[model samples]
Target: MSEVLEGVEKAEAEAVQIREKAQSQVEEIQRDAERKARGIEQIVRTQLTKEIEALQKSVESKAKNKSQRILLKADEEAVSLEEQGTKNIKKTVDIIIKGVYAFGGGGK
Candidate 1:
């Protein structure tokens, strides 16, 4: 009977040790999972940042090109109007000269 009692105690002790070891393993696995999750989050954030920057650059380039085109068109229109004004001024001067000559009787 005493030998059976000792054996029971030994079995209980081994069971306690097994429980403690299993608890420790569970804690380690949780820590490893947390670390991996953090790493994955950081990788996703970096990728998003890079994509946003690239999109911003593309938008800026397109806007710049559009602005340049608008300015070139404005400049072309200004030149056309200036040429038309010059032609009108020459016609006005010729009309005035003819009227003056007729009124003055060709300077007598």
Candidate 2:
């Protein structure tokens, strides 16, 4: 009977050790999962930041190109108006000269 009691006590102690080991393994698994989740979150944030920057640059480039086109068109119209004004001035001067000559004011 004494030997049987010793064997029972030993079995109980072994069971307790097994339970503690299982708990420790569960805690380790939880820590590893949390670390992996944080890494994934960081990677996603970095990718989103890069994508947003690229989109902003594309928008800026398009706006710059459109503004340049508008400026070129404005310059062309200004040149056309200046040429028209010069031609009209020359015609007006010729008409005035002819009138003065007809009035016999050319000798003076």
- Candidate 1 residues 44-100, lDDT tens each? 999999999999999999999999999999999999999998979988788888888
Clashing residue pairs found in predicted model 2: none
State every prediction's TM-score relative to the real structure.
0.61, 0.60
- Cα lDDT tens digits, model 2, 1-108, are 999999999999999999999999999999999999989988999999999999999999999999999999999999998998787997878888888887985622
Tell me the TM-score of model 1. Answer: 0.61
Error of 2 at 57 (Å): 2.4
* CA-lDDT, candidates in order: 0.94, 0.91
Give the Cα RMSD of candidate 2.
Answer: 6.9
